[model samples]
Target: MALILSQLFISLILSLFFSLTLLPHATTSKANSSSEYSITSIFNVTAANHKTSQILSFKPFHNQEEFPQTFSSSSSFKLKLYPAASLYNTHHQHKNYYSLDLNASLNPGITTGTSNFLVQIGVGGPPQKFYMIFDLQTDFTWLQCQPCIKCYDQPDSIFDPSQSSSYTLLSCETKHCNLLPNSSCSDDGYCRYNITYKDGTNTEGVLINETVSFESSGWVDRVSLGCSNKNQGPFVGSDGTFGLGRGSLSFPSRINASSMSYCLVESKDGYSSSTLEFNSPPCSGSVKAKLLQNPKAENLYYVGLKGIKVGGEKIDVPNSTFTIDPYGNGGMIVSSSSLITMLENDTYNVVRDAFVAKTQHLERLKAFLQFDTCYNLSSNNTVELPILEFEVNDGKSWLLPKESYLYAVDKNGTFCFAFAPSKGSFSILGTLQQYGTRVTFDLVNSFVYLHTLCCN
Candidate 1:
């Protein structure tokens, strides 16, 4: 994720603070300290073109926290949050994934006073209709609202901080005051949050605490949120956001499981699977709590990368190609879903060129990208070139592919895509291409381990 302007402001302040404090020197000396974080290998598998496979497996946790010091205390470090649309496939028995409404026409569909699509924020099943950017890079859930606003249209229950009875705001002098990360504060002691997207969209308001009720027997109280008087764009449809990042500051303060797995896909394609799992051997019980690895400030978690083989020929890219910076700063967050989509398109582009050069049709390869949309397979009227077969991890290893798995489809069709949701860029592997694969994300390690498993 690329750093958003807002995050950049904070990074700069942090950078300056650490630079003068000899933090660079301190960093070297602290490498051996208990503060050092490490990620254990969970799972990995080989992957191939247009195929579903399982790569890695690891134990899932109920919750995890990120260290705030990960951000350098540099005044010049400007990081911003980019909001992105994500796909979540909520099926446990069947393969499923969320779908995105790609610019049906590439020309932002014209809408009435109401935007063509409505973004909603909900804790449980029912969606609270609101304008929001379904961000893939964010894990914390929050919303913009008044103490008592028009929540009658919400599909899910809405939180009325006024009635929360236990709702409390963090004092300007409270330890949680830093939760806002960015934004200004009001004289009334309300925390102000201002977020702007790369698309030039912006939202700002006073931060408040509230209750979020989810059907999973999990209810989060005292969650931080932005109560906006003038929320612009499609975000005004709901009360707040449902963050799915690795942080602990989102709505639904508590969950049955320590980890939250989300897969953002095209809304039109539906879900691929209902449940996602992270399985790894448990850490030694005697291991000190301090030994638990924390996510690196600049690192993000991602699945495996077996390497790419284009047209029976392997293409070499640095391991960094698969590494993601989940921090929503200047990093990446690629998923199997998006990889499928991208590889398909790229393969087709290559075949189109091959046919043109030979002045004859090259036999089309029997292949499928990861997406589940029918449009992807339909030539209907558009006769696009055939897709190319690229092996991930050189066919030796793979990310086990399931019918439905949650993943970030490739963002922006770029190979080295960076997903900075706070800036409104969510890098996902779309279903159009990513269909099968057991993928694992190591938030602590800057590597994607993949082990491909065949689709049943």
Candidate 2:
């Protein structure tokens, strides 16, 4: 039977969103073991399959160069998280702006828009805790501050820079101010910025330098960030945005950390807060992959996706189907913001057919537009799912746990394959497939480490 798609898939294709955030500046676990980085913070992922207005087309600013190009690159950011860095500093001195969409409920019961995942962070000296979206795509970080000319209605008090003794304004001549995308000198001589988003959300305020802190790492001083005196847009839940991009201005790069990772906790209908570790070490039996760059979308994370293996058997598919184009087209992308893992049609079909065959015994259900393979297995039935092996060109293969690939749609035994086919040439290894695994984006070495994380 020819498969058809569903509203969920339609939404995945049409939906838009924003963000990324700080990885690790330090490290800490529940057992309180001192591991790699000095400072580490654990945040939560408000996992949900909420529906909203469909985003018709992906607006490319290079697009995802944040979601590292719209959630088809994380929709768009109010404080746009573009990858352009300060001219001089490719590492930390680059001119850039990034965003973090803290996953707080947006007018619950109203299907206007839906968001998932948020991380808790501390900003300023004697750091104030703020819950922000944990987006790993963009590089700019910001917070809604007081003395507001205009501000979004957030549950928490807007941060008052005046209350933080460590707050210091950036001068127009300062290297940090010079690095901002829309920074200018105010009449009063302080550096000012006006960040505009795709949906017309804008945050304008003074560029300031303050001490930002994390859990075990204590305080990192002179962190350049935005203190939005005037804020507007769909970002109405948390205090502000956080950067987790490749630009020098990104919190991870600024700290000069070698590596970091975020293990997305699976809490399918509800929010299960997870952890974000900076300078994280590789887990035992961890696999590695070289992090490639897409010239067409340089700001996003591009990796060499070799191919896939089903139940220890290699799926026969051409390498070019998963390759990065010389012109930088049609490469595979892995993003935490994107909800579905989209693959190029040719490759997806092969994987889909094999997956369906493996679970052929279970009673099949009508296809959800968003997912092609689905089954209505009884609660008491025991079916074995194929062990999905994702291969990276860097001589490593990452096995996706069952929870990462299969999703339960309802209280009954209705379940579906979480992977989807891309309408475009590229493929995205999205957050849905990333759950229950601890993966690290190694900044210094330009490699990624993947291993199963079963946090107690």
Candidate 3:
């Protein structure tokens, strides 16, 4: 079936408040144990299919050089997990933000969108916490505060340079400063930088450093991510992003060095779950995420997809059709996280042909053919269309449940939903597509695997 495409513009805004208070036990978990631990894991079970194949079109734009290029291929497996830095009430203040805990199975302990945290700018006598987004896409991290002129209102937290005792800025001439995409030399002898998000939100500031905490294998450890003096976002709650990219101390970086490993689970509908694992001998050898060695160059990574099948029928889903990011050192790894959508002509063509040829049954499980309606298919409340079964990459083909087609938002701002082809087209599988089972990514070996699937 061909899909109809349409464009709709919608503006969404949410409000949050903040209050600051000092944390009693900042280093409690890290200072105590060394046994293997797990991160958050919340994988939903359900299945729905979409004729969506349009959201995957990542075109080349003007600043193409600024962005990385991604390709597809495969290799081994590995998994690793790091304790995400906590962004609770460590600083003394009040804020209107919701705190979601991390799961040991799939979910990472990250507060979603515009949420910032407060932390001391630099290591010294008195440490202060500022609110910032711990953005995975971003490399350098900074805070918006008193020092930044007319910074966005984020409760009591602001990067007030005048108030900080040790506010040193990077020099424009420094090679390290130039490495930042937005870094520029300012007239005031301080390195200046400005970063803009895809949604047009931006943050500008000077560079600095601060301690960030995350569970490494079992114990909590303080690592330094970027620190910005001036920062901005549509929403504000957390302090700043702890870089998880391929940089030195970020999650990908750690996985690369220590060969960290992890797993993720995706469902036929649109929900996901994951688990991160890491095992490094203290002061023994180096470890890193094995899967990240030859990344796609862009924000996307690769996880060796085995196969997809429906009702025991194997379907041919190529690796080139979707983007994947593998994590960990040298073990089985998976991720229930993916931002893929079926939008491209080539991808849609594949789905159209697949269904046109192999689909033996066309069932409309719920909802009206037109309009925003709802229905109950065999006792299950359904929103849109009925359930269609097809095989995944090739591993094990099973029934794509109808309930998996719904959507939800998780603690880390991980949102899952299904987008079929417009009025008459196919559907796209996205992060919202991976909802159940344990998805694993092996950075060390470079392979993607699903632990198990929910049966209907």
lDDT of each candidate versus the true structure: 0.29, 0.57, 0.32
Per-residue error (Å), model 3, residue 109:
23
Question: Please, what are the lDDT tens digits per residue for candidate 1 over residues 1-456?
Answer: 345443333222211111110011122122211222121111111111111111111111111111231112211111111112112112222211112223211111011111111233232112233333333344334554454333223222344445435455655555445655565667987666665543443456566555433322233445565555444444432334544344544331223223322222221122122123222312221111111112442112333333433223344544433334443322223422122233223333343344233322222222212222211211211122211222233233221122221121211110111111121222234332333322333333333333222122
Arranged by lDDT with the best first, the candidates are: 2, 3, 1
Best by lDDT: 2
The positional error of residue 311 in candidate 1, measured at the CA in angstroms, is 6.0
Candidate 2 regions with alpha-carbon error over 4 angstroms: 1-115, 267-273, 393-396, 454-456
- Candidate achieving higher TM-score, 1 or 3: 3
Write one digit per residue (lDDT tens) for candidate 2, span 1-456. Answer: 222234333333322221111123343342111122222122111121221111222222211110111011111111211111110122332211222222221111111121245555556655666656555556667888878888876534578776787899888998878777788999989999887755457789998888765544345678788888897666655456766666666777666767767666632122233467676566665667778776655656766667787765679986766678787667666675556677778888998988887766667888765666887754433455555767765445666644555655542455678777776667777766776677777877788777755431
Best by TM-score: 2
User: Where in model 3 is the C-alpha error above 4 Å?
Assistant: 1-135, 159-168, 215-226, 229-233, 247-296, 317-319, 322-403, 408-429, 435-456
lDDT of 3 by residue, 1-456 (tens): 122111110000000110011112122222111111121111222211111211112121111011112212122222221111222323524432333211111112121222212222222113343333433333344555444554554533454555544555567786656666667877887677776665455667666543322212111223223445555554444445434333443545532444333322322122112333434211211111223332323222433333333222344644443333343211111221222233224444444444334322322233212111122222222222222333234222222222343222211111222322221112233332333333333434553333323211
Q: What's model 1's TM-score?
A: 0.46
Pitting candidate 1 against candidate 3, the one with the higher lDDT is 3
User: Weakest 10 consecutive residues, lDDT, candidate 2?
Assistant: 64-73
- lDDT for model 2, on a 0 to 1 scale? 0.57
Q: In model 2, how large is the Cα lDDT of residue 311? A: 63
Ranking by TM-score: 2, 3, 1
* Of candidates 2 and 1, the better by TM-score: 2
